[model samples]
Target: MENMPMPKTRKPNAQWDANATKIFNEICVEQVLANNKPQGCLNNKGYANLISQFNERTGRNYTRVQMKNRWDALKADFTTWKTLLLSASGLGIDPKTGTIAASDDWWEEKINVMPLCKKFRFAPLDNDEDVEIMFSGASYTNTNAVAPGAREGSAGNGNGNGNGNCNDKDNGSDDVQEVYPSPAEKQPVKRGAAYKSPKKGKKNFRDM
Candidate 1:
């Protein structure tokens, strides 16, 4: 019930922790597998289930508005990540690490062009699989596997609105699938360009 927004507050200064976020994304992915998405969104029932599961797993009492806010925040960051994937140049995906690898100069230039992408310089999104499950759309446009009617520099930006496809019913279930490598697995490499010896960590879950 994104449009229904209620409960404008949370436990005073309460925030999500790493494990909680992991559990939350896991639930979202489960919901997607269950086909609970309608109109490219998890319907009221799906969100309700999410709330229940998230609270149960994390022991936090985040309300609808809080959950919705987090959902929106994650979507926005994913959109930005996709945007960088499509718009950046002189960057390569590290096969071993699954992170976008580039040099200091490349990172500098890219960050200057899109500061929102700065975080990606170090790590990748933690639950990108779950993110796509909930918000896959034209906003996820990419070069090799582009979405319909989407082209380069078209991954949800000011020039266009990235609307999701409407399909299936509301609510869903989950597993923990990290699309990109976690920081723990990363081994620092010499800061030279090319996909050689790339940094494995995200612009990791810290920014997610």
Candidate 2:
């Protein structure tokens, strides 16, 4: 009889402590808002910077690969939490309650209000407007791969998607909203607002 090859076992991911997870989420939100990038946007350079900052702030050493892996896991969990919350909210059920009426025990056990709220400071459940902005920006895609020609201020002219407006000038309308926390906070906080884009103006092709 031919010898059968043994099944390969994958190593389990390192568990991130509560503090590490909190700091990582804060860093992600801050970087996204400050750079006017996207949510969950962490490039290689950004990852290195985050590692340095994490070490400086917490005095803990975490490699880039480790941070990236942790981020991936956290993001997946966060996404699941958001989906469940949205579904529950749609049915007029408060997710903070003891049990989610539309969900199973697994979801009920996995969905914790404090962590979900803390992780997604700008979650839609807390603020409906934030969700609108998130959908409008649609920056959830890989932000590092932004096209060279897709510079800021050329909003409606890039790739026919009309979503590249990222200037600082404000439009004279109340539609734009600011979701980032105050500088004093230095961390993510729950608030309802959209990621403000540049004022709408005549498109300048040169800037593209």
Candidate 3:
């Protein structure tokens, strides 16, 4: 009989706690906003930086595969959460808990169709903005990539985006609307009592 080849042992997955997950999400959000994401995915250099930042912040020695796994998981979570958000648009989010304001029955019904959504119902749904930026195609795709000439500027910022200075300037607003006093607040211009000006060549003499 032919000898059977032995199966390779599987590597254990690195489980991230809440703090680590939060840190990872925050790093991903920052990178996405910095335009490190192209076509809804991080470029090679961007991914490296993301890994470095995530490991630094969490003090964990996670491999690239682990980070990528978490990234994929987050993307899936965002998709599920978004669908839930649209379906339950009328439901309010609790300010204190950050969870959706829905009855148990509603969640039960939704979870049957979206089993992945079960985690969100019980867990505090935080980082709404970060997840939107990191996972949403619409958000990341809108950002323009670094122009050929703008590479130096991006390199200086080290975020791999176009014109690093422009991002902050954009957030500050380009077209600042000047606020003028209301008509009621305007003061009448002060002028000398309606005295006619002297003729062009003649000057008015003061009373002796």
Candidate 4:
């Protein structure tokens, strides 16, 4: 094949170049406008700061010139991307403060108080009303596994004093149960035939 001369690279068309230039100028103008706007919380130099933070987070080297180009590209979409800058760069400036600071501690506290918080309560029986009866007999048996009474300071072991067998029956009657009244409901015990009153030297019905 005969060697064909390679066509010289054509210069960009004048009309196309002019259109591209217009677009570029429009983009630069938008960037300047966005940069000058009074963003309530974002710093006056937000674009520059955001670029530095972005490079730090991505572990990539982005030169200032690259950041400038990116800023120009993103200027028209500032509102949508503002949150990304705020969260990632800790650039969540407080509007009232006019300067960025660490996010408010109350933000975490508010989260803790909500349903989504880790400290939220969980109750399997949140609204349950029916509770099973624990004790039914006068004297609870060993099978009940009852906790120790406060007076004895020792857990029950079937016997009344940790010595008697729980299986023992008192005449096979339910009367074997010991009636213990709450402190608020207690009354003086009646004097019986075995009672010896110090004042009377004998059982006193009046004391009862």
Q: After superposition, how far is residue 195 of candidate 1 from its true place, in Å?
A: 8.8
Model 1 TM-score is 0.58
Clashing pairs in 2: none
lDDT of 3 by residue, 71-131 (tens): 6666667677767766765566644335566776787899899987776664434565567
Global Cα lDDT for candidate 2: 0.41
* Model 4 weakest 10-residue run by lDDT: 125-134
lDDT of 3 at 144: 36
Can you write out model 1's per-residue Cα lDDT over 1-208, one digit (the tens) per residue?
3687577652443376667777878887676555444334555666778889988887777766666656655776787777766654466675444557666677678779777666675666667766754566422211223245532223232212223322222232121222433567555533334443224432222122
lDDT of 1: 0.56
**What would you estimate as the lDDT of candidate 4?**
0.28
Segments of candidate 4 deviating more than 4 angstroms = 1-44, 76-208
The segments of candidate 2 whose C-alpha lies over 4 angstroms from its true place after superposition are 1-15, 36-40, 93-137, 140-208
CA shift of 35, model 1, Å:
2.7
Model 3 reaches what TM-score against the true structure? 0.58
State each model's CA lDDT, in order: 0.56, 0.41, 0.56, 0.28
